[model samples]
Target chain A: MVSELSPTPGARSVSADTEGPRPPMPVKMVIAGGFGVGKTTTVGAISEIEPLTTEASITSVAAGIDDLSHTPEKMTTTVAMDFGCVTLDPTLKLYLFGTPGQERFGFMWDDLVEGALGGLVIVDTRRLDDCYAAVDYFEHREIPFAVAVNAFDGKVEHDLNDVRWALDVGDHVPLTVFDARERGSVRDALLVVLEHALATAQQ
Target chain B: MTVGGGVTKAGTTREVKGEDEMTAGEPSAADDAWGVEHPPSIVRPFLLTAGRIAGGDSLVPTIPIETQVVATDLGLATLDAFVFDQHRDIITICRQPQSLAEIAAKLRMHLNVIRVLADDLRADGQLALYAPQAESARDATVLRRVIDGLRAIPDSRGAIRER
Candidate 1:
């Protein structure tokens, strides 16, 4: 004989177990750009903590094994990233992660983006193509993101419109120029990313 | 049938076969070789803890639950919504059952601080203590499953699902 065991109508499933309220964790954002575009500086400016950086000296053994041409002048490399925190409100916190500014470190991007709210793509006007790798990565991943042009000294100058045209950024994407070293500018760039993330999440 | 050991056919009696007689000795032989022994019984116990932390507030412990410990223990930290915009480093390290002094030494934290956190975690049900060595294996399996589930969730920007 077939025995059928079924719950009565309107019976709640055991899956609805977590009904109580809990405090939320802070949101996370990543600062990404090409080599020496000021991703670390931007994160350090706004971070409340003594920015934790995992920079181990590139040893001679790693000289032949790893590519050091783009990173020769640098004494320390962000093997993982630099982490810092900022309080946005009484109930929310924002965590900033500065990713290594080289295309070869693309493998680490996926882990950095996990659970992150979104990112600010820091670009330098001198080398517009420098930001292309990050842009492409974010686009392919369908991650909500915004681009901020870092105005480096003696760098090639370009207006926001020209930069947008060169990057071929779509109309929905937000683009702006800012001094990465300034706190207010960095905060504004972050706000743009968060706003975009919120808008996209709503959609 | 003849008395003692004999087989009887209809209207006739004869000596029993050697095979039938040998079969009767098997039970005696088994009893002589090994006496009966009962299997050992074991019992296991465990505890579970959970807690919540408000923005700018320290982690607060909740009530603890007692149950059968299943495997090795695990610790996890979940960030709040407000802090999601900022980046922070969070690392979890496990300490085997030990005194507050030992734990502090291993983690390089002050003894008093470790005690405070441990007590809070224990009360909140976030920290779990298991009993009976067998439970360790089970706990390891459960912790692995939990980690796998967390990793399976998509974490990219704009990938968060609405409540």
Candidate 2:
């Protein structure tokens, strides 16, 4: 980023604007799970501002298109995600982006997690299978991730150990019980993910 | 299993060798003259990007979708020096600094489209991009800062005002 906002060609002096207010250093955390896993709820809980639902027009290939050079028509899928920002301070900002609700947008994950701090995979106790793909993606890429079982009604249906065994996550991955509706609960859950990522990286 | 995918048609396409994943293949000159379109809105995103199609991370360097973007003095002042309306919209929305994703959400454009357009504006000195550190995920300092920041946020029920 330019150290100083450029002067408007003699209209304003270089010193007119001090501190060269550039955008803050971005820190991203992915909130991923299968459909209806409270992924959006988790983001809204802790974000300073209202969460925004954004759509991405993803161009994905349909089945049976083997010859790339010969094919002309293409399929474009619309994927919508919910995201919100927390201003860590003036110099840093943390963004929570919920992965697209649908599972087919697997190709979008590489772009989402490449430079992110880590991931918080939300799971509803009854449907543990919804998050398997997310867990696999993060683990396979060696990106540190934590699992938060969203106890929607404040009543957790199963033990944390049961979820661990079901998800088959290693002991290294932090598995915690959290209520998706509470701000503190989601915040602590995210901290666990960051701590896990930090610890994993240090080792 | 693509759910409700809309398969759009394409005409003859020319390959564009690019330096980053933001790159999209150029629409062949024969399809339509480059930079010459009837109206900006409702134009196919690929055509709006002039048919520059980008793919996975393995192929090219990329800006993390969360990178911040702000308008330059020039961008804040005028729409001249830019061909695409998307560039102009980026400049206008960026008068106050915003993340690339926010801009995409505001502009209702695809993330890659915003990436490509923002890259163009930055190249033209119309916008500035502040990407996170190269190894941000592994940066302990950044992680510590984020952890501290999260700690500072008020977690009380009152902290969350209904939107």
Candidate 3:
């Protein structure tokens, strides 16, 4: 009996038993915040896969090159951003990118936000002004965004309404509380941002 | 040993080793010197086919967000659908245990294009390369560690609600 193996549909036949084609999947989201506002933690929380971090040693030699005014206590700096992924639905994938809070990393913002659908600007109520740069950056670019107030313990005692008023957030913008340390909160915050984006896009 | 030097149709006298010096029914010394005594006939044809296929390289078929099988199979269709619409036709196409060249060819795109797409896809966790079969243990361990780490991290929302 002459039996021949046939190529399966959606599968390619190659001679060498060495390698096969790679399936394609890519998605991105930006995590923006003031210095030390827990952007990295928010990403690390809900990331289904190993998060790729670009945090590097803050050497004195490179101090002059990059600004570290906001996060003076930070020993490491996210030179670019932290990358992670989560599957929201059967066909929806979410990529979390933690943007460097320092102004010197400004050059990277354009590239990082290239194809991003929207962003989460993590805020520390204690240092609300610190997040102004991120807010302005995203706003000026006309990118959809949500303000996630990362409430740190013993730092501030303000209601969510106060935060909204202080931040001058319009009613249309979604304001939510987030703990950079918790995965569910971060996930919720991300969802809020995504929902806000979807709503805005609909209009 | 009988010594006879004669130039025939080839015009070159070749030194023939005796059966005693032959191993596995062939000249052991000559086989060792040449590395391969007799190469399989299929090698040339295979290489030629590979070359031809790679000639018109374009871009590898990246994991189509809407059309990706892995995401659907893994029950991540919702996530895949979201990403697919946001970034249409942007994905890293990887053949299972595929060679760099084969991947490049299958995409029908340039090697650099495939490479960039692959890098992005890998960074995004949409594709993974299968290493050595024996390294499954190591791969599993690494995957476990990553999952554990993710699980250990406290959910940010919990902290927010507490305050």
Tell me each candidate's TM-score. Answer: 0.45, 0.76, 0.46
Model 3 lDDT per residue over A77-166, tens place? 113234566654332344566765664433236545654667898888878876766776777677778998887663446788898788
**Cα lDDT tens digits for candidate 2, B14-115:** 222211222122212121111222222555565655554433421223556777777878667666655566777888888877887888766766576677
Segments of candidate 3 deviating more than 4 angstroms: A1-25, A55-78, A103-108, A154-156, B1-163
* Cα TM-score of candidate 3: 0.46
Using lDDT as the measure, the top candidate is: 2
Which residue runs of candidate 1 sit more than 4 Å off their true CA positions? A1-24, A55-78, A104-108, A153-156, B1-163
Q: Which is superior by DockQ, 1 or 3? A: 3
lDDT of 1 by residue, A5-40 (tens): 113111111111212221122345678887777776
Question: lDDT value for candidate 2?
Answer: 0.67
* Candidate numbers sorted by TM-score from highest down: 2, 3, 1
**Worst lDDT window (10 residues) for model 3 chain B?**
B11-20
lDDT value, residue B111 of candidate 1: 23
Better of 2 and 3 by TM-score: 2
Better candidate number, 2 or 3, judged by lDDT: 2
